[model samples]
Target: MIAPPSPVPDSKISLWTPFTFSLFRAIWIASLVSNIGTWMQNVAGVWLVTILTTSTLLVALMQTATSLPSFLLSVPAGALADLTDRRRMLLFTQGFMACMATLLGTLTLMGNISALGVLSFTFLLGMGAALNGPVWQTITPELIPRPVLPFALTLNGVSINVARAVGPAIGGVIISYFSPGYVFLLNGVSFLGTWIVIYSWKRKVAVSSVPAENFIGALRAGVRYVQYSPAIYAILIRAFSFSFGASAMWALLSIVVARRLQLDSSAYGVMLSWLGAGAVSGAFTTGIINRRFTVNQRVLIAIVIFTGTNLSLAFFPAAYWLYPVMFLSGMAWLMIMTSFNTTVQLNLPKWVQARVLSIYMLVFQGGMALGSVTWGTLADHFSLWIALVAAAVWLLLSAFLAIPFPISPAENLNLTPAEHWPEPTVQGDIDPDDGPVVVMVEYMVKVADIPAFRQAVDQLVRLRLRDGALRAGVFTDVTNPSRITEFFYVATWGEHQRQHHRFTKEDLAIETRVIHFHTGSVPPRVTHYIAFPKAPNVDIAPPFENMEGQS
Candidate 1:
């Protein structure tokens, strides 16, 4: 008799969910109003500072104040967010920000505000934003299911770019027509609308965690987690590059439009609008990624698309072509940012979710902050187009850096490339009898050694768990697979111990199987990770079952 077909995995991630749409709409509204104020404040603030101090250093310092909180305290706040009620935390932050904005407006109306006063209020706003940033991210998955989590994340990006494009024009108009203080009042009032919506809502999941008692200990823990992780580290570096290389353009874009393109304010506004349209288009386009390519391929594609866009911006002939070029660049930005964010959500565990996000913010937007200042300085000396060209060259260089490390995308037991696999995913402080942490590492391994390596890997797993600190195992490939494709896998340890830790030499024997097994005539290419899903089901694998109480 013919055998029945094996069960196929369920794979339908909704692109259009009510929860997703509501969250997107709410955030877009919030951003549109507040960002308009923010942009107006940014433009007016810088110009105000320039008029007051007549010093670029003073203006630079003012801009830096806006981003300082993210650099200084996102980690601790992230740990705090993971420990407390995220929504409640956000409520407090939002309310505080409104008060700060109101005060700034009040001072401006009284004509009593100074550079120092501006700095104080801006720093307060940054503090609230640091708290809001982590919550904004980690809270989303709780609202929408995992399947649509990516869609929601992409939508989140769409809202930000829309704000980036539109907020400035409105800000400029309001500031020019009335005074800048009116813009601040608009932001203060806008918070009430968001607050009402949040209060009326009911959540489907509890998006809170027990606070880590040792605050510094928790901070160190977050750092060490990425330090030991290859895939996580690689992604972090990619974010850093994007921030440093590509993001500098934002600072110079206004200058380019004003001087290089010799465009008037209205023309600049039109050009900016094209960016939002491009980003929205790119956001929707990524839904097909699951159907067409692996995560690595999408990453590579994002890099190429962004790099090409930047190159076009660097070489555009006339001011007329600027709109079309900026539009495509916006699209490219969405593709890169969304794909990277999805990778973060796909690869992390709930326990460390906020911490990873904190790091992502530190690297990505932090890099932008760094780039902005750098570009501003560059523009004072060089022309804006020269600055844009310099930034474009750096963008191309960063993408090329990623080409060497291509993490394979086969979700299985052994995900790392053969030689460079880190063993913590298999045997570490984490409890294995409980389950595996699915880490994604990108490295290189050889093609010819597939057969013998598979045999050795099978041998390692069959061996009983080692009694020492390292307890390791490996699963062989179901298919021989591509010659040099990136691999993804699930690695299990019974528990992740947070207290004091120790390891013995006995842990090394079986743990080294994947590295040593590739004995072919040539070396193999590979990359791997030990991933921790945001919400892990302990029952799916009995190993994770016993781990519930250990940590």
Candidate 2:
């Protein structure tokens, strides 16, 4: 008799526990500093653009420039992260960003910076961030143990918000006393801290026996994985919706503070601090909140609350009242984002983790970019109040999406590879690069069991496709009602071998269930066929006989 599965370690992680791990602490602190610098740079960049041009469209485009690169490059970056050393990749990107910031700062100090120059620098900085994002996320699992990973992720978000809370206020004072150029210079210096941390990290890289996938192939696989995963799709949709609406607040808040409230840079910075304060509070209490509500419930509630905050900001003229509204906005932001991010992190397997996360990032950052442009134009043509109200309405309508696509808990998903498939028996030397390969499994069942068998095979189709099958289908014999054939095609023989390595414990369980339904005296018959275009005279035939006990 088989034993029951082992229980997952209870993850009663506290806010400070993750910091106990020395490496995690080092990187976390470094990352926090870097995030503060980034926010400071953001405040300076937008303010600089505003000073150069009063056009709302151009001011909002600064936001777009900072996010659009993620949409364009995240997938490729993710693939690269998976293919190469994540640490080195981050080092390169961070160094490049530091150089770009320094150049922009130098130009600004020389009074040579223009509106176009600021946008260009922002885009370049975003490109670095876009490439760095997936690598950064994928490396988190390597930094600490699994039980405390949730806390680490939560702390990471909190760190960003902490920086957001502090950076803008510091930036405002500096810009007031010194200039925006000094802010840029500080941002440039901050990148070195992260770079030094990464460089000093002695990461042990895992070496794989199988050849690494080509960039294009890896990208395609990542996209296919996302397409087949319902959980990821739901998360991405929610991310897009929430980000598209929330972006109006981020893109237009400076304009609102300056023009509507007639506030100086100092007040504007303090207002942003309130939003960050709310986020910090939300992060700290997220564990308690999650315990009280389901993911769907929490997400919906957060959306409604955030919408209320936006509406309050639009209609209410008093700046003091807006402080609380901004605070609520920040809280709602953390609740929704943390929910989506934690869900994705738990659901993904290590093999495809970076690639899948890149897609999620793409949707999230893309929505912000698109929304910034849309809301900025709306504000230019109509009014800031109208744009804010319209965005809130869009956010409220987003709640209905929860009905069709509910978020599922991923605690039970065993993503560890089972490695149960036996190595194929081969007749002769077969090239790894050999042409398209076909895999077929034959099953014989009682007439009554056919329906159940078909249902099982239908479920297996998605697994087959997700694991690397280019195409998969189930077929029934015309001569015998008891016979069923399941087949899938792969691009190359090497890919078929990769698929063998991709099966998980859950997949093995499913395969066992299908096998139990088979009525054949032996186990299901399995065969593999490889195409050979060079030898037209050769007839490739099945190499194996009936295997009764093998599954």
Per-residue alpha-carbon lDDT of candidate 1 for residues 52-143, written as tens digits (9 for 90 to 100) = 57667777788678888878878888787766667688778878888988888888878999877777788888888887888778866555
- Assess candidate 1 and give its TM-score to the true structure: 0.68
For model 2, the superposed segments whose C-alpha errors exceed 4 Å read 1-12, 46-61, 106-119, 179-181, 252-267, 375-386, 534-551
Top TM-score: which candidate number? 2
Every model's TM-score = 0.68, 0.88
Model 2: how far is 254 from its true place, Å?
4.6
Q: Estimate the lDDT of model 1.
A: 0.62
Report clashes for each candidate as comma-separated counts. 46, 0
User: What are the per-residue Cα lDDT tens digits for candidate 2 across 453-523?
Assistant: 88888878888998889999988899998898899999887778878877888688878888888887888
Error at 138, model 1, angstroms:
0.7
Error of 2 at 151 (Å): 1.7
Clashing pairs in 2: none
Relative to the true structure, how large is the alpha-carbon lDDT of every model?
A: 0.62, 0.84
Please give me the total number of clashing residue pairs in predicted model 1: 46
